[model samples]
Target: MDDLDLPTAAPATIEEFRDRLTEITDGLPRRLRQCADHIAANIDRIAVSTVAELAAGADVPPSAVMRFCQILGYSGFSEMQKLFREAYAPGFPDYSTRLKNLKDGGAGSPSALLAEFIEAGRLSLEALAKSADETALAQAVSVLAGADMVHVIGLRRAFPVATYLAYVFEKMSVPAMLHDGVGKLDRRHALRAGDAVLAITFAPYSEETIALAQDARDRGLPVVALTDRPTSPL
Candidate 1:
C-alpha cells in the first residue's frame, strides 16, 4: 500500500515474481489481492490472457488489473505478458504432446526418459536439502511417531506420494488413514483428539486438503505439512 508515486523495477524471473507476490499479497487492498490470487492460480494462462479476461477472472475492473501489474513493477500488462511469453516461447513442444508421446512410448527413448526423471528427482532432493529446517523436521517426525493415528491427505498431483506414505506406514505397523476424497466423501469427521495430520500439497492447493488440515488444527491435533514453500496455506 505504497503511495504508488515511484516506479519499481520489475522482477527478473517468474520465480522472483512469485516470491515478491508472496511477500506483498497479504498487505494489499482487497481488489489487488484478488488479482494476485487469480494470477498465481492461473499463471500458465498469463501469456495468452488479455487484461479484460484477467479482470473478469479476478472479478475486478480492468483498471484494477492494470494497477495490480503496476504494483508488481510492470509498466503495464504487456510488459508482464512479455515476461511470460518469453518463458513459454512458441518454439518448444507443448507439455501435452510430450506427455502423450511418453504415454504411447513412442517419442523418446526409455533410457533418456529414465535419466530425465532421475535427474529431476535428484534436483528436487537437493533443493529440499538446502531449504529444510532440521528442528522442524525432527518435530514432525516426533509428532507423527507419537500420534495415535496419522491422517494423510493429498490430491491431484500429490495423490501418489500421499498414498505411498500411507502404504509405508501400514507396512511398518504404524496406524495411518488416507483421505482420498473418494466419492467426495467428507472424511474430516475421522479426525480424533489423539490423531495427527500429514498434509501434502503444492501451489494452487486442494481445498479439501486445506480444510482437513484446518479441522485437525482446530481440534488441537498436530499437523505436519509437506508443501512447496513457507508462504503456502497448507
Candidate 2:
C-alpha cells in the first residue's frame, strides 16, 4: 500500500524545506545563509522571477544561489526554482494582491467561491501535513493527557477552536476550562500548579492571548501555543 522503493531526498516539499531550513539554515556558510534568508522573505517572487533576478535581489552571485540549491538536493538553479515555486504556487500572488483581488471581485460566483475555498483548504492541509512535527505533537499529547486540567484560551478567530477543544476535553473527562472572558473574569485564576494552558492566535497576535500566555508561564503552568508562524506572540 506504500511506495517502499521511493528514493529518499532532501526537503521533498516547500514545507519540508522550511522545517529543515529552521533547524539547519543558521549553521550554513555565509553565502548560502544570505540566499536562504532572501528567499524566505521574498517567497512570492520565486515562482515568477528568473534566477538572475532573484540572485540580484539576494545580493549573491548566481553561482552561489545554484550552490545553495545543490545543498538542498536540487540539480541546479532551475531545479531549485521549481521547489521555491511550490509554496506560493498556482497564481503566486502576494497577500496584498490576493486581498485586492477579493475586493475587486475575484470570486464573483458561487462556483468561483467554492473553488477558492477548496484550494485554500487543500493548501492549508498540505502545509500541515508537511510541516507539523510528529515529536512535538506526541509531546503535547503526553503533557495534556497527564495534566490535572487544561486551560484552553483562544480569542477572536481562534475562539471556535478553543471552545470545541474545551468541550472535547470535558467529554473525555480531562478537567479543562475555556477562557472566554465571560463576566470579565481573569482566566488565570482558574489555573493551578497541576494545570496546563493552550493558547491559540495568529499574526498580529492578540494582546489578550499574549497576556494569558505570559501569565500562564509566570504561574508555572505548562503552556502550548497554536499559531500561524514560529514568531507568533502566543
Candidate 3:
C-alpha cells in the first residue's frame, strides 16, 4: 500500500498543521489553547519526540499529533520529525513559576491584583474608544435592526458573548441564530442580501468560525465583527 494508505500518517501543509492543533486542543481553555499553539509552532526548534510521541506526551491523540505537524507546513509526521531532530534545543526560565515570585514582593496581594485588573480594563476601554469608529457601529446596528435573519457566530472563549448577544436580540423580537456548533448552523437555508452576521472572535481565532464568517460575507451578508484586536482576520 502507498503511504497515503498508512494508518499513522497525515497530510503536510500549514492548514493541516493549524487544523490538527485546533482539534487536539479543542476543549482546552483559551490560555491552554494559546500554549498549545506556541508549542506546536516551535516544535521544530525544540527538543521533542515523534508526532505520536509528542502527542502522547502532551495528552492528546495521534490524529491531533499529526495535525500539529501538518499545521507547521510539513509533508507529514516523518518530515516534521526530521526537522525537529535537526534543530532540537531546549531552554526556559519556568515562567509559570515566576508568578509565585511576585508574591514574595506582595504583588499577589488582593489589592495589588485588583489594581492590575482595573488597569487592564481601563487600557482595553481606552483602546476600544480610540480604534472603533462610531459610524461603523451605527451602520452595523442599522443593518442588524433591519435584517430578515441575523446570525451570531463565536467559538471557544467568545461563545458566551455570542450567546448573550443572541439572547438580547431575541428579547428585542429579532430573528437571531446563535451558531456555537455545526448542528446549530442551518446553512441549507439561503442567506440573502438583507441578512446580517455578527462574528465574535479573539486571538488564535477558530478556523471553522472564521470560515463561517467568510462564507456569510461571500453570500452578500453584511458582517459586523467583534474581536479583541482590530487587525483580527474575520
Candidate 4:
C-alpha cells in the first residue's frame, strides 16, 4: 500500500500503548518515561488533533507535547503519528491493556520515581545543550544589553516571562517596558527609534505581540524574537 493508504493504526487501548512505550524507552530517563506514559494515554486523541488542541487534551504544555514527539524519534507530532498509524496496521492496542501495563510496570517506590525524574531532567538538559546555538544566544544578550530602551512583549503564557524580564531589567538599571494588558496603547506611544524590542511568543502566535513588534519595526526599532519556531511572525 502507498504511505497515505496504509491503514491508520494506533493503540486500540491505552494499556497496549504503555507496553510498547516500556520497550521503546527501556533506557530513557524517568521524566521522559512519564512523558511517554502521558503520550501513550492520550495518543489516540492527540493523533488527530492540532498541537494546541492535543496539548490541552493531554493536560500538558504544547512544548511538552513537542518534546515528547522528539523523544519518540520523530521531528514533531505529525511525523510521530504517521509512524504510529503505520505500525498499528491490523488493529490498535487496547486502552485498558496499556493502562494495566503502566500500573504493573513500576516499583511503587519514591526512590525509584525520584531516580526517573532526575534522569529525565538530565536527558532534557543534555539534549538542549547539544542543540543550542551559543553564538545566537550571545548575540541576543548583547542586543538587550546595549539597547537604548528595551520593549518586551509576550502574550498568553509567555506574558509571565516578559514581566519577569522587565522586573529584572529594572533591578539591573536597564530601561525596559513590559507592554501587555489593556494599557498597551500608552506603552506603544512611548516607543522610539534606537530602541530594541524583545518579543517572546509561540505558535498560534499572539496577535498583540506581533502587532507591537511590527509597530516598533515601522518606527525603526530593532526587533529580536524569542519564539518556539525560527519563522515565527515576530
Candidate models: Cα lDDT each: 0.82, 0.74, 0.62, 0.66
> How well does model 3 score by local distance difference test?
0.62
Query: Candidate 3, residues 1-234: lDDT per residue as tens digits?
Result: 321232244533333433455455545444435436555544332334455556655667767656544544456567855543442222121222334455566555789877755654665455346435677689988988889989888889998999999999999899988877866655625556778888898878877678878888778778888874323576
Number of clashing residue pairs, candidate 1: 0
Q: Lowest lDDT 10-mer window, candidate 1?
A: 90-99
By TM-score, how accurate is candidate 4? 0.50
Ranking by TM-score: 2, 1, 4, 3
Q: Pick the candidate with the highest lDDT.
A: 1
- Measured against the true structure, the TM-scores of the candidates, in listed sequence, are 0.58, 0.62, 0.48, 0.50
lDDT of 1 by residue, 66-172 (tens): 99888888889999999888866542333444556667885367798887566546654554564356778999999999999999999998999999999999999
Candidate 4 error regions (>4 Å): 1-122, 183-186
Top-TM-score structure, candidate number: 2
Candidate 2: list runs displaced more than 4 Å. Answer: 1-83, 86-108
- Model 3 residue 113 lDDT? 76
What lDDT score is found at residue 46 in candidate 3? 31
Q: How close is candidate 1 to the true structure, as a TM-score?
A: 0.58
List ranges where model 1 is wrong by over 4 Å: 1-25, 28-108
